[model samples]
Target: IPFGFYLFLKTENYIVGWIATLLTGLMVLYAVYTKSLAAWVSISVEAIVFISILIYLVKTGKYQFKIKSRLYALVLTFTGFLLLINIDSGGFNLKFGGLSDQVTSVQEFVQSKSSSGVDVVRSDAAVKGQSSIEWRWSVWLNSMAMIKDNPLIGVGAGNYKIEYPLYNHKVVRDTKFNLESQLDRAHNDYIQAAAEFGITGFVIALWAVVCFYYILFCLFKSDLSDLPGKKLLLAAALMSAGTGMLFNAGFSFPFQRAIPPFIVMLIFAIACVMHAQKIKTSHTSIIDTRLLYAVTFVFTLLFFYIGHYHYTMIKADKYFGRTIRCYNNGNWPQLLNEADKALSYNAGRKRVLFYKGFASNELGKIKESIQYYEELIQYFPNYINGLLNLGIAYGKVGENAKAVETFKKIIVLMPDEGGYYSDAGHYLTKLGKLDQAYTYLKKGAELEKENAIILLNFGVLCMQMKKYSEARKVLKKVAELEPDWDQPKQYLKYIKEQT
Candidate 1:
């Protein structure tokens, strides 16, 4: 896209540049219509470059249209653009026909939230409902604080997601903020790199950026004495691609994507080539043809190796998808097999860790299941299913104490839910900790008011403690909650006899 702009410069055809600018302006309007600030920002770079070219041409007297004519053209063009944006039948239909309402929205929101904006953002985050803007700010601030503490080698590459759940540094926060998912990216490449790579790698990255712009700077200021305007425009166009991506990367994860960062490097490489071309030295070829071919062959092999690596990774995702289908269908053996296939390609896959453990448990490999469930819990401490199933697995293997411990962790993570409390109490009964079991079961029954399963468990615990009257009351409630259940009715009859 930028190369097209460079072509106009090469031919000294400013008319084509003007045409491209006009077309791009329509895109900008559409971006506005769709409320795409990012689209507006990226395409605006071309408009800026064209404007620069226009300024350069006019100053050099190459654009000889009278000033009055230029002003009239600008007014008429802008008017038509507005009409296109606000047409009643097929246009944006924006209120008042322009971006005035957007500006007003900002002003009104700021005025309304001037004193409590931080609280508002924090309250939103408390329930996992933070807007993207607020969410990014929290993650970025927490990540930066983490980086500041570990200023040397970072949290280790690709460890940010794993680290985020345990790290609770806050810039403006609520104590109740509970992140259900670890942020996969900081959403800002610069901050993400700092948190992932630390100062050591960060400085190296900063150096590369400096070197890129330095080359661009040299190209721009180099005495192009008698050199064609083509070089200036070309340099500006190439640099525009890099700058536009740089701007996008500031607020988004362009580096995490496949293409945008590639474009940045491509432009940087082109700029380097341009800078090299300006050298005045008459240098001869430094390498023979045979060595050049050797380099080419080696690079070709490297590319193939990289391609193969990505292919295997993609194959892993394919198997993971199949594994998910099998798991959902309760096909334990197939799920286990597919999970192994995914693990073979990428051993560190987090979800696969739990899926393999779950399938192994379902297939009656209790001992093996314990190990994998333990591994999964270690990987994600706040994982509800992992903790819940791990506790159950521990109980199956007669590790009552371990089961109780795992359920205690779940209770901490989910204090409002009564199921974990009931689970903990059940294990405590097996451990003969009757008093602790009574405490947990009572809490579970209170929290899970209408949960027949919880009430039944609580009633059984009461009977075990020889409190027949309390057992009778709980059993009656369980019978009410589940009228067709034979267990509660049978328990109620037994309690009747005992009473």
Candidate 2:
């Protein structure tokens, strides 16, 4: 697509940025996953090149307007209406859309979660009227922190989740801020690359983008003028192709789809056809058997590898997701077994680590649980589950100071995550940091006042602080929120009797 984009740069800005980006996005969606730096660099460069071309075209008055006939306009209008309906239709809420069948199990999990009182608002909810954006943002921030600590070699590809907790432990140890289960990749491409492949991979990825832009523009200026509409064909193909990739890349994983292969095939086909035409026009040799054979061999190999790779990833992703289901269902043994199976195929998988860590915790192997959680935090620090669990494990081990520090790290990684704040407060209260405990609990309560656990934690803090009136109010709320919880009910009763 990048190569194609440069080819269209000389013809029109409309052909370059907007159109090329859309094409690039579509290709990316077909074959690759964008959770890495390579994909980002590719998209960013194509977008930048297109925008530059657009500006130049606008400045030079070289932009050609394409007028639509009435029939064409009507077709476009109908297509637009159909697309709008598709976008707004609640036919399927799955991200995979038509591919939803392949992920029926995931859809089931989503359905169950929706029924479990979890709002999609988690996507944009404030932890406690604080910036939930910032909370999500912390994943990026902490990921960078991890890269800086181990810049040259990286903690290891897929090691951020494992290393993050150590950094968190070093910085703030009060709350659980595990990264193992909460992330599949670094939310940002640049950060993920630096963490996984170090500075070298980051630089190479950027360089590839630079090369793409140069090639795209060169192709655009190549003279096919004497051949009439030949130039337009080339321009449309490249522009349309690049645009698809860039647009799809903006929000979803385009790289993991078959998009890349199709885009590449389009480019290769254009190059071959154009070269053959140029040779024929020049009265060159009738046939080039060597080049033909090479192209055939290349296509065969590329398709073969692509097919195999796609299937492998599909299988791995499914089993990985199933491991999560096992954990959620409290099938500890199954979780452990499935995690091992997943790791055997794709070792150090962050999601698999979550199952391993949680299952270990459930099985009373605190040391083993901590081991997996710690490893996950180091490699995938952006994830929060491991950190949360690690803090809980520390609490279980009676390492109050370590527990407090862990929770504090969670605050840094996701300050608005009310649950982290609540957990931190609970541990801080245990550590006799009464003032800090009060501050955190109060803040957490404000975020999710309807939360029975948060209110109960606050009531416990108030009781310890000798603020009996505040304690009474908080415990009353706790009782209302969880009438079945004997702890809140008993505490409230004792307070009333004393009064």
Candidate 3:
């Protein structure tokens, strides 16, 4: 009966279970981290849990079922009620989640880097994905559709961006708005796998997880001291990771993070190995030293393989560092050389392609730059930097329509502010979409009313649209804002001549 009870307890206390319990608290804490009072209940609940665990460990000299747990539970319940009161009183923007709001700062940083020619090439994908309620819905649907088309083998690893647009017609029927344009990635792991590796790779990955859990189960069944406690902790950690995965497909760079999963995997793998060896020793009639030597040899080989994987990635990172130095120093040829070296180790990396494209563009290798941009977009379609550069490359080839369409995508993805809108407006005006151009220019001017450049652009757009009175109004504002600014004076001259 005790054994049965333990099994039931074990099943209920699985890693996923602990994660679910903690996720609400994590979300609440994330909000709190960003200074939102809406997370007070979550914070209180987390505090209660933390304190309860500490008290139980301290008072009972046992790991479970203590006064501390009861106290925490009580605090959590009380905090949840208080949370309702806080939200009702504060009119929060539900669409603007804490994660999305954070992206604006990142977007500003990326823009600044781009302007300073930092060669960092930070992606706007996250910012675009966060800001666009519409694009997210479209991309999610399109990604699933791509998965459905190639359910078994998938399109291939790193192929989802290339396949994204091909699957778009099913989700987005209209071509007028350029919604059918392929996103670079599914922007999701499950979807990316489904589109790239097919169901086979995904299932293999799933099987790996299942096998890992089975091994963990075996560990719990053994006579390891603190087995239950470790299981509970591992389960909690796994749950948190799994929860994060569900929302983002591991796009937050888990595979790159050196801690957390690696430590957790090592712990679990060690426990399983130890438990298996103990079980075999208990049941075996005889053991061969030769067999032991063979097993050790195999382990050594496996260790080398894992080490090589990490070493290659590290080497790639090192080469990228060199590329950054070259870019910073304005040595275009050296930047290209570093990019080539980086790609020799990790060809699938998008940032490498971004630099290659940027360097090629600067060197007047227009065709070569376009190829790199195309490759980047094919690999990472949702990546905003790639999209922007690809458009610029196309513009260099006299594909203004393609450029205009690409810029429109940027405008749709990023919030209409700063020069992003103004640049689009300027290009749209060049394309003779005077009315559309004026609207964007006006919006950009409103976002930065004090800016002499935006004000002058607005004045020029108004002149083109034949809104003479509006042109004069904007030009006069610009002149007042910056008397010495030449563009506003030139625009004022042109407007007076038209009049």
Candidate 4:
């Protein structure tokens, strides 16, 4: 991406442009360290295409350069960078593997490295069917089945994650490898959009993509000779990046990222401006001083208008991050203090409220915890974690009624989840609603039949209800499930005495 930007700048300032190579080299090293196959592929493809364009321009006499000097400069800069990296790392060696190695993907490369001196031969077909890739395909396929149910309106926002678990059981049932975990993202933005918002999201995404390419088309089909030197390079560079991004989006969720979309649109906007200027057929420069100033002013105005809000948001995020760190470190007092500071900046932020509640509860300030939880639930009633935590907090405070009510709502949201039913049942037992509690406990045990904790709770509930025979049977099963657990033996002995 930095290399692409360098190409864009090369048109205006050839000397200044080579400096971007420093950024380019560092980014490549970063990609290698991170093992980001997507970043590597994006950079590689862009470099190949952009370099090809440069070669074409020079050969066809459209552009000229001191090729030898530029090549030598590039080599020296990269070599120096690598030397520094090696020195800093105390032996950061890079090697070009034999042609026979032919590592195709980051997964393959990692596999090869982990089993050093072993050849990891992967067939072309197995490349996509590899565990990481295959399960994504399975998810996409399963997600489609779900979308077919209500194609037009979708399952709705926040419903996808809760609801998808039901449809994705087929993949989970696979014995060889249950490669699926969270279906939070389908990893394909287009499909994810369709899954979340239905056909409406798919159409909007498709249209935006089409319009994006149309701008690129306008810029590409223009008389390359007519546009200034840098403008031509700029268009080609943007085209490479935009095309690379489109490809990456198919495999990953770059659209969900913070920077990629903005970069894509920024380049797209530039293309549109260049295309419009061409259609005008004015001999005036494609990017004149007036246009630059206009863009500068508009961006400046926007920053001034939106800057304060972003500053506050950044501040809130930092504090929230610190609160999480505090929570992780088990520093409850600091967590409450940090979370409070964050809430002061963004009082309505759901996570800040949740964390504050969590800290307060951990600090034994139950009333304060309830207040923070109530605030979170007030703003985000359907936030599952907030609701779950709030419900747990209620139980901690002996507000069994509120806890049972909250768990009931959770059961409605996640009916198939045994944990929610267990929560509801546990609270109902506390409230002395024995019959209703039994129904929930039975259902929870049925859903998660092998869940020892829920089964033990159910056994305890049966004992409480004085159904001695049923209690003995349930307690025996719990003993089998947890052979060493003393509670089941004690409960069985008590049940024996009762009988």
Model 4 per-residue lDDT tens digits across residues 1-499: 6344545346345565565655666666665555455555666777777677677666755555543435655787678656654443445544321112224444564664476444333333434444554455556766777788879989887566656654553322211222123356767777777888899878987898788778766665556555765566677677777777876777688888899899888877887888777775546555588989999999999998798888888899999999989988999889888987887778756658877887888888988888988887776565567678889889987999999998897676456678899999999998889999999998998888789899899989988888888878878988999999999999999888878
lDDT of each: 0.74, 0.62, 0.61, 0.72
Q: Compose the digit string of candidate 3's lDDT tens values, residues 82-141.
A: 453344235634433344554554575456536746332223343343333334444666
User: How far off is residue 241 in model 2, in Å?
Assistant: 1.7
Write down the lDDT that model 1 would get.
Answer: 0.74
Candidate 4 Cα outliers beyond 4 Å, as residue runs: 2-25, 44-187, 192-198, 228-231, 251-258, 281-305, 325-338, 363-368, 409-418, 431-436, 443-453, 462-470, 480-487, 493-499
Candidates, ranked, lDDT: 1, 4, 2, 3
Deviation from truth (RMSD, Å), model 2: 11.7
lDDT of 2: 0.62
TM-score of each: 0.70, 0.53, 0.51, 0.68
Candidate that would win on lDDT: 1
Clashing pairs in 4: none
| Winning model by TM-score | 1
lDDT of 1 by residue, 8-109 (tens): 344434455556545545655566677544445565775676567557645764433333423443455567777677765555664534457545554654
Which candidate, 2 or 3, has the higher TM-score?
2
Clashing pairs in 3: 15-235, 153-198, 154-198, 156-196, 183-381, 184-380, 184-381, 184-382
Per-residue lDDT over 1-499 for candidate 2, one digit per residue giving the tens place of the 0 to 100 score: 5554444343344434444444533554432332333344455565565565555444544444332222343344445434433342466233432333324544554554467473323332322332222333445556666778777877776565455544543322212243333344544555666777778777886675455444555544444442324343454445445554644443333533565646655664664455444343554673989998999999999999999877777777777887989977999988888777777766635658867888998899998998898888776665566678889999999987888888887787666568888988888888888999999999999887899888888988888787889999989888888878899878877788877
